[model samples]
Target: MSISPSLDTDDLDAREVTDGRYTRVQIGAERAVKVRAAYTTRFVATEFTKRPEDFHMLAGSEVHPEAGDVVIARVTELGKHTRLESPTSRRQLLFVGQEIMVAYGNRYAPDQFLAHVPDSLEPCHLVAGGGLAGYVIETHASIGAATAIEPIGLLATREGVVNLRDFSPLQVGSPSLAAVAALGSRRPPVIAVLGTSMNSGKSTTLACLVNGLSNAGLTVAAGKATGTGAGNDPNLFIDAGAFPVCDFTDFGYPTTFKLAYEEVRNLLAAMIDEQAAFGADVVVIEIADGLYQGETSRLLRDPLFATYVDTVVFAAQDALGARAGLDLLHDAAVPVAAVSGLLTASPLAAAEASAWIDVPVIVTYDLCRPEVAAALIPVRAALL
Candidate 1:
C-alpha cells in the first residue's frame, strides 16, 4: 500500500511516545507490547472519504521502510471483500524518508496489489510511525452520536501521529488462538461483557459492576473489547477497582479492520483464557461497537456471543433502538442479562424504554434502585 503524503512519511523520526520509558519503533509504541491487541488496515489516502489527502501524496510509492518504519506490507490475501493482510517478512525495515526500494528482491507493486481488491470491498491501508502506528482504516462516518472516543487535543506530535492511548488492543491475553486454545484447555471459568451498540453503556456499566463486584470481595479482572482507541476505558475500569484491565492495543492490532472474524474470535478466546489464568473471581469486559449493527452483528446472533460472553448487556440510545435491540436478541436467540443506555440517565427516558423492553432497564446513576444491575448479575454468572 502507498503511504499518504499528509502522513509526512517524508519526516520519519524515532522518538518516545510522550513517556520516554521505551523507544518507539515500527507501527507500534515501544519495541512491542503483550497487551490488548487491536487491528486495523490503512488504505490509500486519496480514496479517503474524510481526510482524502492522506493517500493522494503517496500515489505510486512502494513502502521502503527505514529508521523507525519497519515492514512495507502488501496485501497477500484476496477476498469477496476488501480485506488487507499483513505480509510475513521480517526483513522489512522502517527508515527515515526511505522511498521503498522497489527492486530489492522484487517487491510487489502497489497497483498490482490494489488490482486484487474486489470492487465491492472497501479499501484501506496500514500505517506506521513512532507517535501513531497501526492501520487507520477509512470509514464513511465517525462511530456513534455519543462517541466513546473524544480526542484530547494538545498531544505531542512525535513523528507526526496520535494513536489511541486510552483503550488499545495492545494489552490483552495473547496474540493468536493456537496459544489461547492451549491456555484455555487448562483454565477455569472467565467473566465477560457484551453489548448492542456504541454508547450502549458498556464501559461505564462495566466500571460500575467492577466497583460493586470488587466491593463484594470478588477478585475482578476487567478488559475492554473495542472502541475508538483514543480514550482510557480500561483505565476507567481499573480505577473502578478492577485489579487488572486491558484493551486491544496490548495485542498489537492498531485497528479493528486489521482483524478477520475468526482471528477476532480466537484472540477473544485467548483473552478469556488469560483472564481466567489470572484467577480473577469475576471477569468484566467492555465490548466494542455494538451487536446487531453489522454483518458481524449477525454473527453475534448466531450463537457466537453465547459461546464467548458470560453475560450480555444491550446499550441503546432511545426506546426504539432498545426495543429493536431486544427483538434482535430474541430473533438471534441471544440470552441477554439486561438493557441500559442514555435513556436510563433520564427518568422519563428510562420509563419509555421500560415500556418497550420488558427486561429490567438500568440507569447507572440510580444504582440504589436494586433492579438496575442487581437482577442481571446472576444471569451473567450463569453464562460464565
Candidate 2:
C-alpha cells in the first residue's frame, strides 16, 4: 500500500507492509507486534459514514492527540451519557466494556461539560453526545459526571491517524473574504440565529424560519456556524426542508470551541458558499451559545461576520435575557429583525420582551408563515 502524504513518516523504518489485510509494524527493533482489535467497534457521530473496514491499524504511541483525531476506546463507566449517537442518528445504548470509535475535540457547553483533549491517552470523558472524547475540567452541577472511557489507540490507516478533515465531503478549498464581499446582490440573503445560551431555541428558530422560507417557494440552505458537533440540529434543518444543510462538523471540525477566530470566520464563509452553490434563495445559519461566549462574541464583533449576515434572529428564554441579548447585539451593531425562542412560548414573557425591545416578538407558528418569514429578509436581499 502506498503511504499517504499526510501520514507521519518519521517512523517509516519501524513499520513493514504485509500481504494480509492488516499490516505488521515493529514497535521497536527487538519486538514485532501485530496489534489487532478483537472488540466489535461501535462508531459514533463524528465518524459519520465511516466503516470498520476503512481503518487497518491502531497506534497508541502518541501521547498527545489533537482534536479530530479518531480514537478507539473502551467504555469504563457510564454516567450522564448512557447512550451514544450513531452515525446514522440512532441512539445506541452504551455498556461498560463496549469499544467505540470517536473523535477528540474540546467541548464548551456550559449546561454540560467543559472539556479539552488530554495530554496523554489516559482515561477521559465522553463530553458530547456527538462522540467528542476529552478530559473534563468542569461540568454543570445539575448533571452527573461525564461518561468515562479508556483510549485503546487512535484509528489509523496507511495515511496515519484518521482525521475527519481527511474525509470531508465538502470541496470548500479556501475561505476568500474578497469572494464573499463581491457576491453583493447576487448571493442570497443570510439570516443568523443567535441565542442567550445553549438550548435557548436557536435551532428551532432557524428550522422554523427555513421551513417558512421553503414554503414561500424559496430554496433554503442552512448551517450551524459554531458549536459542538451534533446531528440533532442538522437533522432538524433537513426535516424543515433545508437542502445543503451544514455545520462546523461538516467542515471536519468536531466542535468549534477554542478554534482561532480566522478559522471560524472561514468556516462560516465556506458553509454559505457550499449552500449557495446549490442555488439557494436564502441562507440561514445558527451561532451556538449566547452573546457572552468567547467564540460567539468574537464572530459577532468581527467586520467579516457582517459581510455574511444580513440580519439576526435573537433567541432567549426570558424577558430579561431577551432585553439584555438585544442590547448586546445593538451595541455590536448586529441587525436583529425579531425576537423568538423559549421566551415566545409564554405570551406573558413575550409581551414583556416586546414592550422592552422595539423588534417584533414572533412565535414558531408565525415564523413558519410565508409572509412573516419573508418580512424577516432584509430589504436589499428581498428586492433581489
Whole-model Cα lDDT per candidate?
0.43, 0.77
The sequence of per-residue lDDT tens digits that candidate 1 reaches over residues 123-224 is 223222111222222322432111011111111122222223222333333343433445535333344454555566767777776776666656777776
Clash pairs detected, candidate 2: none
RMSD of 1: 14.2
RMSD of 2: 6.1
Please list the residue runs of candidate 2 whose C-alpha ends up more than 4 Å from where it truly belongs after superposition. Answer: 1-54, 175-185
Model 1 scores worst on lDDT over the 10 consecutive residues at 101-110
Q: Taking the tens digit of each residue's C-alpha lDDT, what string does model 2 give over 1-384?
A: 223224434444544544332333333312212221211112222332234333534544333577877677889999998877776667778889887777889989889989999886789988887788999999899999999999866666555666667665553565335445546437788899999998889999999999998889888989988998878999999999999787877677888888887888888878887677667889899999989999889888899889889999999999999999999999999999999999899999999998999999999668999889989999887932
State each model's C-alpha RMSD to the native: 14.2, 6.1
Which candidate number would show the highest TM-score if scored against the true structure? Answer: 2
